[model samples]
Target: MRLLFHVQHFLGVGHHRRAEALTRALVAAGHTVTVASGGAPVPGEDWGGARVVHLPPARVEAADFRTLRHLDGTPVDDTWREDRKQKLLALFGDVAPDILLLEGFPFARRQLQFELLPLLEAAKAQPRPPLVATSLRDIIVFNKPPKRHEEVLDLVNRFIDLVLIHGDPALVPLERSFATADRIPAAKKAYTGFVAPVPPSTPNRIASVVVSVGGGAVGKALLWTALHSRPFTRFADQPWLLVGGAMMSEAAIAALRDAAPEGMSVERFRPDFRAVLAGADLSISMAGYNTALDILQTGVRSVLIPFAEGGETEQALRAQLFAEAGRAVTVDQAGLTPDLLGASVNRAADLPPVTLDLALDGARRTVEILTAREAAR
Candidate 1:
């Protein structure tokens, strides 16, 4: 089966990374996959045997996530939207895929409706319309208004054939964030568990503390706090590896590095971040979906300071859930300080590794689900 997957990540690379994992899994399962990415490319992403289509990229200008701009910082105007829509339609016509998978839409990434609506229209107009599914992570941002939920429900019911909730329902259900999830037919809804990398063997475990920010776009506060808090912790003399995500500016990275006291080191990104986490004494970072998955798979003691800007509650909720389960410690963004962060680090470091019962075979399960759906069709 030929599959066309669309993903757009504005703030961080987590969304694209998960999509890439699913793409690779689908390809491994003997399906030809084409990924259409609308966000700016990360430095060293591996799509793995799947065809890639780079749409005119755009990124969030601020924590508000309201304004989107090109890599050059120019605002995305109507002309750019039109071009992207045309390109997407052209790609859809060319691929004529057996399955059309949208990473997040109606549920999230409503900003791309300009192109996605048109793409959906084109897909439906096909004589034998391909199965259209929305791929989503466990928790969604819960700040959307009631009207927004209604809009999403209407769109899903009208166009989407399936909603693959890529998370363990036992851990966190779709309705927690999406209030109207029950409105979607049960036949169209399926859980594929949480998509995460299989834990690699820890052959060369680095003993330093690991701190990371997903994509490095909005992690300056957390990174800076962690750097300063390192000196205040019991492991003051131990090495602290601070990863400033790929999107972090070099100037910001240099500033953080200069601010670091004796035992701390800083870098832009780490390709083997999960391995680094697996070997570390403790993990410290924002509680994004991918980062949380890495922490869970490694079962590393962790201190999570979820990014709460722009009224985003997804990460905060995830951190709270993990904390309640004793998997990690949480430091609310509002009360984050060097002393508090240091205390949390010490507390998390002293805890034993947590063994979670949630499913980690989501990528493979996703492929199986899509393949079965295709076969039935």
Candidate 2:
């Protein structure tokens, strides 16, 4: 089946990463796929042999997401929005896909309604409208206003044909984060395990400590504290590789490299990050969805510090759950201290390697679901 996958990453690239994983899975299964990316182009991302369509990229200037800017530093005006919407409609006409998969729509990305709502409408208007679906993560932001919740329900029930949740219910159920998810029709929701790249079967050649933060734009505090907290931890003597985020400033990343504190090395990003994590003695990182899966796949001893600033609770909840499962140790970002982190590291390293019984084939399963539905058609 031909598939049109629309993805946008305003800040952190986790959304884009997960979307790409699923796209690749679809392509590997012999489906024709096209990825329509609406965010700034990542330097060296691969789409698993699928065709890509780059839309006018708009980036969030800050965490508030109130300021949108083009990559050339121009503010996004109404004219840009209109043009982008027209292009999206044109693409819909061109692809005429059997499956229309939107990443993070009603559950989030409310900011892109100008374009997304029209895209949804176009698909539904087709004489042979595609099977519309949404690709959602395990947890969404918690505690939204009552009216906002109703609005989401209305949109899903109105436009969406399927909701593919990329998580194992054994780890996190949809209702756990957004209680309103329970209201969606049972047949419309499919928990497809966690959408993550399959880990390498090869063993690691080097043993070191891996420290990373997703999207580097908002993880300065975590990386800053980590640079200094190593000495207090049990693996102070082990080599450390600190991965600087792609969005982090050059000067900031350079400063980290300079302040390596003896056995630590700092780099912008690691294409081989998963393989490195597989053989690491310990991992110190934030609790994002992809990273959580990495820790799960590698069974790496880990200390997870969930990003919890500016009313962000997604990571906090994920970290809490991961820690409760004895998969990792949690350190509160609000009250983080070098001494406290060191102690947590010691405790985490002593914990047993992870051995999960839950399904981890979310990407493949997602493709299978779409294939089966298209076949039924």
Candidate 3:
């Protein structure tokens, strides 16, 4: 089966990375996969054998997430949107895939309706329209107005054939974030569990505390607080590794590196982040989907400061859920100070690692689900 996967990540790389993981899984399962990325390319990322299609990349200009800009930091205009829409349509016509997977639309990425709405219409117009599915993470942003939910439900019912909720229903249900989840037909919904890389066998546990931001786009506050709070923590003298995400500017990384005290070190990114988590005494990071999965896989004692800028509640909700499960400690961004963060770090260090029993085989399960759907078709 040929699959065309569309993903757009404006603030962080987590969404695109998860989509790429699934694309690789599909390719491994004997399906030809093409990934259409609508965001700026993540540096040093390899998509293996999957064909990559680069759309006119755009990113959020600020925490508000209302303004978008091209990779060159220029504001996106009407002409650019039209061009991107046409290119996306052309790609759809060229691929003619067996399955059309939208990473997030209707439910989220409402900003891209200029292109996605037409893309959905074009796919349905096909004589035998490919199975259209919406691939979403565990939680969604719930701050939208009631009418937004209605619009999403209407779109899902009209165009989408399946809704792949990438999480365990037993752990966190879609309805927890999306109020209109029940409106979508049961036959169209499937919880495929969380997607994450398998843990490495031998982890390099060189650091006592591991701090990271998802893409480092909006992580300055967290990183600054963590850096300043180290002296107040119990493990003040221990090695603290701070990872500035790929999206972080070189100037920011250099500044952080210069500010590092005796035992603290800073770097741009770490490919073996999960492995480092496995060997660390405590994990400190924002509560994004992929990072949450990594922390769960390692079962490391953790302190999660969910990124809640721009009225985004998904990460905060995820942090709350994990905290309620006794899997990690949560500190609200509003209350995050050096002293508070340092104290939380000490408290988290005392807690034992709790092994979560949720499914981590989403990549394989996704292929199985798609293959079965294709066979039935």
Per-model TM against the reference: 0.96, 0.95, 0.98
113 Cα displacement, candidate 1 (Å): 1.0
lDDT-based ranking, best first? Answer: 3, 1, 2
lDDT string, candidate 3, 1-377, tens digits? 98899989898899988887898889888888888889989987767699999998998855658777887877899999999999999999999999999987878887899999999999999999999998999998867788888888889989998899999988899999998799889999988888888777777888999999988887887898999999899889899999999999999999999998988989898878888888999999999999999888888889999988888899999999989888888999997899999999988888866777998899888888888987898
lDDT of 1: 0.87
- Whole-model lDDT, candidate 2? 0.86
lDDT of model 3, residue 349: 84
Which parts of model 3 have CA positions greater than 4 angstroms off?
none
lDDT of each: 0.87, 0.86, 0.89
Q: Which residue pairs show collisions in model 1?
A: none
Name the better of 1 and 3 by TM-score: 3
lDDT of 1 by residue, 1-377 (tens): 98999989887888988988998888888889888889888878888888999999998865657777888877889999999999999999999998999977878887788999999999999999999999999999857778888888899989999999999988888988888788889999999999988786762365478889988988898888888887778888888899998888999999988888777878887767788888888888999999999888887889999988887899998999899889999999897998999999999978866688998899999988888888898
Top candidate by TM-score: 3
